[model samples]
Target: MTDQPQVSAEKPSEASADQAAPTPEAEAIAAYLLKHPEFFVEHEELLTTLRIPHQRGDTVSLVERQLKLLRDRNIEMRHRLSQLMDVARDNDRLFDKTRRLMLALIDASSLEEVVIAVEDSLRQEFQVPFVSLILFSEKPLPVGRWVSTEDAQKAIGGLISDEKIVCGVLREHELAFLYGAEQGEHVGSSAVVALTHQGLHGVLAIGSRDPQYYKSSVGTLFLSYIAEVLGRVLPRFTQSSRPVY
Candidate 1:
């Protein structure tokens, strides 16, 4: 009957107390609110009371935040619309110039005249600084900048592929051959359109002084269309049984 050991009840550790405390179920509450968005509509008062941190280190009501987001999206949409309008105006001007050039080519009677028309239109109308025409034929056309097939292959053999248009900065040798020593030195960018039609093959090269004037990613639809017109019409002037040197 003796001395029984007195048992003392120990207090829980700090870690155990923290773990046992009832924590706010923030994630669960958020999920519930997302699932039932109508809950906000029913409790309209919460919209005015709910505070959201703004990008500028200030708190705003949920309704104010929503308005700010809408305003930002509206501004972005207007900027995009303005860019689209600018592009449309540029396309319209280009189309008009292309039409005039095509008409001029159609009116020309000889290969030399066609060459003059092209150079004049591109320089005076299209504002291109430099232009060159290279024909791949046994006999050369009586035109300035017209190079023989052998000469073209020797200078830019790799560049002359099927009938695709090439645009961007050109190599030093290519620039020299296309624009000559003095002018080529100043040319920073160029576009070369391949010509292939009715046993004829050639290239139409255009150059500009600005390095960024022609880029690899620039559209070549108009250049290709102009080349096609040249191809079809050039044969008409060079259909002689004997070569026109």
Candidate 2:
């Protein structure tokens, strides 16, 4: 007689064990904590006892790590505040200097005084080393550098065409034309502005020894403002004395 096939009790028990395996301890804890963040608030003692691994192979209490993060953020915020304060101070000084220069221009009576006002303020008050104010005319004037319209067009045509401030390093010939050959060679970077109002007046340029100093429009606001004042003031004198094309 064939006996009934006997079922293996071990196989059934093993399958049951595999199916009933619990979630990994660490994963279960993390998931539970994520779902109920208030768990930490209820068990405040864990904050002092929980260890967080540090980069240096040691561990620190969660509370200590939190304090360190707060300290780092405080330092970063302080640095930003300091930078903003520095910029504010600089702008205040610039505004004062600009106010003085505008007053001087208003007080100027003759074309000579006007030229002196521009040159002296830019050199002494503004602390600019290289400055050039070239007037465009059909004939050369006695005061300041005056170039025939043709010569100016040939030299700084690109610079004078734009009403905006032109900044960055300039071509050798352009530099030579604005400043003298010797001085132009020393100008590493410059900002040029075309003096224009009802008509084109001239060009005003300032140069620095540092190549990166005038690389953009960052600091050319004062220069452009000064140029506008000059454009209005200059026409008053030029139209009376020399004709400008």
lDDT of each: 0.77, 0.83
- Candidate 1, backbone clash total: 0
187-219: candidate 2 lDDT, tens digit per residue: 999999988887777889999998999976887
lDDT of 1 at 46: 53
RMSD of each: 12.1, 11.1
Whose lDDT is greatest here? 2
Query: Model 2 Cα displacement at 209 (Å)?
Result: 1.3
Q: TM-scores, in order shown?
A: 0.71, 0.76
